[model samples]
Target: MDFRSLFTRKSKSSSIATQRLQLILTQDRFEVSEDSMKKLQIELTEVLAKYFEFTMNSVSMSIKREGNSYVLMADFPYSKTNKIR
Candidate 1:
């Protein structure tokens, strides 16, 4: 009977679904064979770490279906300290 509860449940469900869909779509676009994605993830993480000290789990880099083509989207947290080096 509470609208707030309904909204919260819907929001959580939608977020989970979106994340799941995005992962699947990304895997599909990259044509990442089972072992390949694992290799790619590791290599990318190492490369990124060479530049900054950040949590690998906190960053996401992937190729996704956008319109008729696939697009690579990477998200990283920025901090003012990065400007120094």
Candidate 2:
């Protein structure tokens, strides 16, 4: 395999493979399944939407093991209707 050939390729299969491996490792380390993540996202979105018009597409929730504790992140834009002057 020549090093120059890698630069000529336009495919991102290498990057995809790396991402998949990291996802699996992260899940294993955190002891969380992909399904749980999806469910949590859906439920949280629903709960937030009830009170305010949330931008679901822009929301991101991730759970990862950090040190000895688990970190959970929920990021989304708040409804503009509730903005104060």
Candidate 3:
């Protein structure tokens, strides 16, 4: 018996709603506005674009809480052939 099949699957709308709720909760907990995060992501992408070729969609930024400290994480993918430096 497969335990995975025992639970009903979530609909796409439900999955999207859950993701949105999680984002809102995370932003509230970190005291950061959605606009501010977007600005930060844009600025980071612009700065990194000077040295590498990557699409804006390839960039991701999020805040994480670790013990007593809050950490900002950013991820971007760049092709080796397009490196400027």
Clashes of each: 0, 0, 0
Root-mean-square deviation of every model: 4.4, 6.8, 4.8
- List, residue by residue over 26-46, the lDDT tens digit for candidate 3: 687768888887887888888
Candidate with top lDDT is 3
lDDT of 1 by residue, 1-85 (tens): 9767866745577778999888887788777874777677667766777787666655676786678977787777668765523
Any idea what lDDT model 3 has? 0.76
Q: What are the lDDT scores of the predictions, listed in order? A: 0.72, 0.71, 0.76
Model 1 scores a C-alpha lDDT of 0.72
| Model 3 spans with C-alpha error above 4 angstroms | 1-18
For model 1 the local lDDT of residue 68 reads: 92
Alpha-carbon shift of residue 83 in model 2 (angstroms): 6.0
Q: Model 3: which residue pairs collide?
A: none
The residue pairs in collision within model 1 are: none
Q: Give one digit per residue, the lDDT tens place, for model 2 in 1-85.
A: 9797779767579988987776676567657788876677788887877776765655675556689987866777776673432
